[model samples]
Target: MKCVGLCPAFVVELWGVLEGLCCVRRLGFTKVELNTDSEAVGQLVKEGRVTSLLGNTLAKQRKLLEFDWIIDISHTYCEVNKCVDGLANFL
Candidate 1:
């Protein structure tokens, strides 16, 4: 989430979610409890609709979900996401 200039925040946020899921999948973890600060990401993922600036990317995120596993996408306020948010900075 650092220095990702000019791109709409929703696009970047959705990209991060997709990439994070990819990593989790590679680790052989099928069930994932993912949390995001963006409500757009959650809504779009749960109910497919490419209405954002990065619709293609969002669509790709949906494509990545065609797996035989349970994935629960949740939303958290930035205030409660403090720990993970700080950790992302280190990465």
Candidate 2:
């Protein structure tokens, strides 16, 4: 986890997804299931809604998706990701 100072929650969530994708790509993973607890980020990615605020980040995410791999992005409840939640809280 990284501290992003102050920003909108969606930005932080999307950035985390982007970073994770890049890390997985570097690790030569061909298939990935990405679970995010942010419903707004999930909806934005699923609906392809590119707002001015999120356009660049979303574009990067889209490009990453275009790579030769299988990627599934889905929304999971925070309760389902207790470890991540605890880590975030610890930070």
Candidate 3:
């Protein structure tokens, strides 16, 4: 397993987990993984905050060989209020 992103929250949440140790290292991967282009990991490395091998970018041609999963979400909220005597109540 390999992790390619620099998401601090994800890294922190993953800490102490066996999967956290398989972070991307030097462009080669033993299994499929996830990554992002935010550059957070690179900055961490430059600041001496992190010490680990990084991965190289895969070619465009290689991208077609991989599968991608996408997700979408929608949210809504509702509120109501009632007036009783001189006091206003919310529900």
Runs of candidate 3 with Cα error greater than 4 angstroms are: 2-36, 50-91
Candidate number of the best lDDT: 2
- Evaluation by lDDT, superior candidate among 1 and 2: 2
lDDT by residue (tens digit), candidate 3, 1-91: 3454565543532231223223322234444333222245323322333223222222221232232422111111112212221131231
Q: Against the hidden true structure, what lDDT does model 2 obtain?
A: 0.86
Which wins on lDDT, candidate 1 or candidate 3?
Answer: 1
Ranking by lDDT: 2, 1, 3
TM-score of each model, paired residue for residue: 0.81, 0.88, 0.19
Count of steric clashes across candidates, in order: 0, 0, 2
What is the full ranking by TM-score, best candidate first?
2, 1, 3
Q: lDDT score of model 3?
A: 0.28
Off by over 4 Å in 2: none
lDDT tens per residue, model 1, 10-58? 7678778878888888898978998989887888888867775667777
User: Candidate 2 or 3, higher TM-score?
Assistant: 2
Candidate 2 local lDDT, residue 10: 77
> TM-score winner among the candidates?
2
